[model samples]
Structure formats: structure tokens, C-alpha cells
Target: MGHADTLLAMGGAFLAAAFFARLGNRIGLPTIPLFTLAGMLLGPHTPGFVLVEDAHDFEMLSALGLVLLLFYLGLEFHLDDLKTGGRRLALAGGSYLLLNVGAGFGFGLALDWGIREALVLAGVLGISSSAIVTKILIDLGRLGRPETRLILGVIVVEDVFLALYLAALQPVIGGAHGVAEVLFQVTKAFAFLLVLAATARYGTRLIGRLIHVRDDELLVISFLGAAVLVAGVSELLGVADAIGAFMVGLILAQTPSAARIRRLVHPLRDAFAAIFFFAFGLAIDPGDFAAVLVPVAVAATLTLLMNVAAGLIVARLYGYGPGPAADIAATLLARGEFALILAAMAATAGLDERLAPFIAGYVLVLAVLGPVAAGRAHLVVRRLTGGRTPDGPDDLAPVEAPERTTSA
Candidate 1:
């Protein structure tokens, strides 16, 4: 197709996604899943007028969306919060990761898949979609809530674990025989992350001086260029671009320019994020999902229960009330990009073709349902327990809405 045609198609898709988001808002629902549903309907595999013919192009835009999304999340999150959370945060995050990974691994083994395939499934099912989580937090105005900090901290821990897991898995699965080669690859991954941490800790002032400008335009350009540059370098060094982008935001978060940087990047992030969700939907073929639907549904149900168990454990450790705990559980139920990436890697490495479609289906169902569940968690719990909130004796009192802070 011509450039004009491509641009028009992309533009139309964006508008449609926005419309769907608005529609979801009117219907008292989350927007991300709606956008993804819109993409599925307009996708090539579905019987409809496909707006995006070349998924590759939309994929690029989607990648940018992820970078911006993670970057924005980092701006909101802080290492200090995790530090202050201390042992509770560590225990909560660690236990949650262990439970999910264990569940996925056991599920794979139960299905009689080999160890390697089980490891792949474990990675897919274990990590929550940070993009989806961040959006829900912002949309619901829950970012500043106490439990939200724990949630973000746990997510950061999960991302770090995922990086290390992928690094080690790639070498092992690729048949790097020697202990030295595997150690070398794992060391490289940690070293890269260590450098990012150091920079975030010590180099913030330098970055501030270099990129902080009175001119908003120059500041935006400078910050954006740095984020993109770091992301590209991270990709070259065998880390995910979103991690690099997030590290940049972490460093900037320490500086005085964080609010401005956030303001400048907000529109870009939202715009590209919509495209990303749509592009994600575009790649999914409805036919491919059918064969794996039953197994995927069963696995998803198991994980959902596991997620609730994990969330409650973490919430109790951190001293959250039942209401907040339920919110954490519902939010953590989502699985997306990271899972999709692992599934794709499994396919690329020929570890398992069946893994990808099952993952696609599973993630689709949960990602859509998770946000809705989170938004209505209080109501669900109330209804389940005979129309009373879960806060012990106070359950009889009318459940008040959570206080939404002005800060994103």
C-alpha cells in the first residue's frame, strides 16, 4: 500500500480505538481491553474490514507505547518507597512471584509438557502486564494509594526477575553447554541492570543539568531522546527496551524535572498506548485461539485463583485492609506483553508452537477481565459475603469509595 493509505489506515484505527475507549467509559468499564477488542474486530483474521494491513508498522508504534508506558510508571514509582516498605515488600513480592511461577510450572507438568516448555509457560503466566496495571491505576486515580506503592514495588521486582529468567533461559535453551557461558550471560544481564541502578542513584544531578531546560520544547526533546537512546542501547545489550526507558524515568524521578517530564510525555504515552493495545489485538488470530481455548480457560481460572491467594498474602503482610487487598488481587490477575513475548520466544526457539496460541488466548481473557474485576472488587466481595464489605465488623457500614488523589 502507498504511504498515504498506510497513514490513513493507522489514523482510522487510532480514532476507532479512542471511540471504543470513550464508549467503555460511558459503560463504566476499563478502556485498554475495549481497545484490544476493537483491534480484534478490525484484525485480518476476524471477519471484518481490517484497518491495519501491515501489523509490522503498528507493532513499532506499540513498542513505543510500551516504552513510554514504563517510563511514565517509573516516574510515579520510587525506589525509596520499596526501601521504606522493607521486609514486607520484599516478602510480599517474592512470595507472589514464587506462587505464580510454581503454579504455571506445575500446570505445564500436569499437562505432560517437558521441563523447558514448562519453564516457558511459567514465565508467560507469572508476570503481570505493567502497561495494563499502570493504566488502571491512573484511570481509577489509585496511584497515590498506600497499597498502590506495594503493587508497583511488586511489579518492579517481577520485571527484574523476568529479565534474569529470560537471560538465563535463552542461554540454556539455546544449548550453551558450559557453566561458564551461562554464568557469563547471566552476569552480563545483572551488570547492565547494576549500571542502570548506579546511574539512577548517582547520575541524576548530571542528567538534570544536561537535560533540564527552561524551554519546554527543548526539555521534552532532550528527555525523549535520552529515553529512546537508553532503550535502544538496552536492546543492543540484550535487555528489554521498556526496562531501559523505565530506568531513565527512575533517574529523572530523583531530579526536579520529573513533573515537567511527565507532563510533556503524557499525551505521547496515551496516544501511543492506544495504538499499542490496538496493534496487540491486530496480531491475534481468532482461529488460532480456538484450538487452545479450553486449556487456556482452565489454566486462566487456576491462575486467577492463585493471583487472589498471592495478593491476599501480600496484602496481609503489608497490613492492608480487606478492601485494598481485593483490589490488589484483581489488578494482579492480568497477563499481557511479557507473556506474549515469552510465547513468541518459545515459537522462535521451536520449544513449543502450542505455547503461543494458548498464551494469546489466556492473556486476552485475563487482560480484559482483570481491570473490570479490579474496578468492581469491592462490589464483588460485598455481594459474595451477603452484601457486606469484607472489613470485619465494619462490613455492615456502607462501603465508601476509595479516595482518589490528584497526583497521577
Candidate 2:
């Protein structure tokens, strides 16, 4: 198709997705699934009503969207939490990741999907939607609740884990095989990450000094240029492009120019991120969704149960009572953009064809259900525990136990 035709197609897709987002907001549903569903409908694989004219162009744009999304996620990384949260945060967050990841892997094995696809599925099911969860916390006016604080700390831990996880996943996704080669690739990825981290830690002062452009236009261009350059280099080194972009974001997060960079890049991230989702749906055939729906339902149910249990364990470890514990669990239930990103990555890498649609359906289910469940967590907690909802000022407060709580 011609350039004008592609632009028109892109514009129409964005407008339709925007309308779906508005409609979701009106009905108190999450926007990610709405946007995904809209794309599926307009996609060539579905009724073929409205097609994106040039799939290759949209795919390139989608890749840029993924890089920007990862970069933004990196910028939001919370290093300060590691200091303030100390051991409690470590125990809670570590246990949460391991438990959920284990559950997902086991489920993948049950489906006989093999080790490679299982790993990818584990990641998709394990990572909570940081973007959606943050929005839920703010919208519900629960940002200051004690459990909410712990939840945010856990998300920071998840973010750190995901960055490293993506690094490790790169080699595996690149068709690395056998125990020795896999181990070697994993070691290389980790080594690269460690070297990058050390550089960021020691060279922060130098980076801070160099990013002192007074002109907003110059600063924005410089920041984006550096991010793209780093991402390109990372790909050249066999790491994923998103991983490279994330590292760049992490480096900038430490500099004084972090806020300025965030302010400028956020709008760009939002714009392209939507394209990423639309492009994902465009690649999926609607006919495949039904075949995956059963697994999606099963996986969603398992994640819901596991996340709640994990949240309660974390909350109780931090000395929170029943009510706040429920809040923490519900808040962690969201799974949206990151899951889609993983599915897209897997698709691009040519993993199991079934994995993509399964992920899309699974995310769609949870993205819609998570917010509603979180909003009603108090009632759920009360019903489950056979106790009235706490209404006092101290109800949402974070309390520490007299003794340190250890992970089970």
C-alpha cells in the first residue's frame, strides 16, 4: 500500500481504539482489553471489515512502541524501595514471583507445551499489570493505604525481576538449546546486565553532568537518540531490543534529568503503545481465540487464586490484618500490557503459535475482571473470613509485627 493509505489506516485504527477506551471508561472496565478486542474486530483475520493497509509498517511501529513501553517501565523503576523496604520487601516480593512463576510453569507442563513455551507462558501469567494496578490504586483513592505501599514495593521488585528475566529470555528465544548452551547464554545475558548495572551505578555523576541541556527540544532528542542507540547495540549483542531500551531508561532514572525525560517521553509511549496492542491483534486470527478460551479460563482462575494467596501471605508477613490483605491481593490481580508484550515477543520469535491467542484471551479476561474484583475486595474478604469490613482510621494503616516474618 502507499504511504498515504497506511497513514489513513493508522489514523482510523487509533480513532477507533480511542473510542473503545472511552466506552470502557464509561462502563468502568479496563481499556487494554477493549483496545485489543477492537483491533481483533478490525483485523484482517476477523471479519476483515477494516484492515491496516501495510502490516510491515505497523510491525515496525509496534516494535518502536515496545521499546518505548519498556523504557517507560524502566524509568518508573523504584530503587529507593530496596533501601526502605529492606528484608520484608525482599521476602514478600521474592516469594510472590517464585510461587506464581512455579504455578504457571506447572500449568504449562500439564498442557504438554514443552519447556520453551512453558517458560514464555510462565512469564505471561506471572507478571502483574503494573500500569493497570497503578491506575486502579489512584482511581480507588487507596494510594495511601498501607497495603498499597507494600503493593507498590512488590511491583518495583517485579520490574527489576522482569528486566533481568527478559535479558535471560533473549538467548532462549533466539533458539539456544541443550543444557550447556542455555546455561552459557543465560550467563552471558546476566553478565551483560551486571556490567551495565555497574556502569550505571558508578557513572551516574558523569551521566548527570552530560544531560544538562537547557533546551527542552535538544534534551528530548538527545534522550530518545541515546535510547534508540542503546537498544540497537543491545540487539547487536543478542539481547532483545526492549531489554536494551529498558537499560537506557534505568540509567536515566538515576540522573537529575529523569523527570524531564519522563515528561517528554510519556506521551510518545502512550501513543505507540496503543499501536503495539493493535498490531498484536492484527496478527491474531479470531478463529483461534475459541480453541484457546478453555486454557485461558483455567489459567486465569489459577492466577487469581495464586495471586490472592500470595498477597495475603505478603500482607500478613508485613503484619497487616485480613482487610488490607485482601486489598493487596486484589490490586495485584491486574495483567495487561506486559503480558501482551510477552506474547508479542514470543510471536515475533516464532514460539508456539497457540501461545499468542491464549495469552490475548487470558489477558482480556483478567484485565476486565481484575479491577472489578479489586473494587469489591472488602466484601470478598468479609465473606471469606466471616468478619465485618474494617471501618476505623487504622484499618488501612501499615503495621509491623513484633517479630520479623520469614518466607515459608
What's each prediction's TM-score? 0.83, 0.93
State the TM-score for model 1.
0.83
Best by lDDT: 2
Predicted candidate 2 versus true structure: per-residue lDDT over 1-408, tens digit per residue:
787888788898789878988998898887778878877888777665766633566877888888898888777664565777778887898888987888988898888877778888888888888888888887798866666778887887788888888888878887877879988988877777777787577887898888768899999888888888888888877778888888888888899998888888988888888888888877777799888888999999999889888977897787666787788888888898878878877877788899988998898888988899899989987887786865335544453211111000
Tens digits of per-residue lDDT for model 1, 1-408: 688988897889889998998997787555666777787788787886978766676767777887887677667666576565566667888899999999998988987767778888888778888767876788788776667766777876776576567756765555455889767765776688789889888888887788778999998888888888988887666566677787888788888898898888988888887787787677667787777878898888988888899978987775556777888889888887677656645654577566766876788788778888888998977777778665433333322122211121
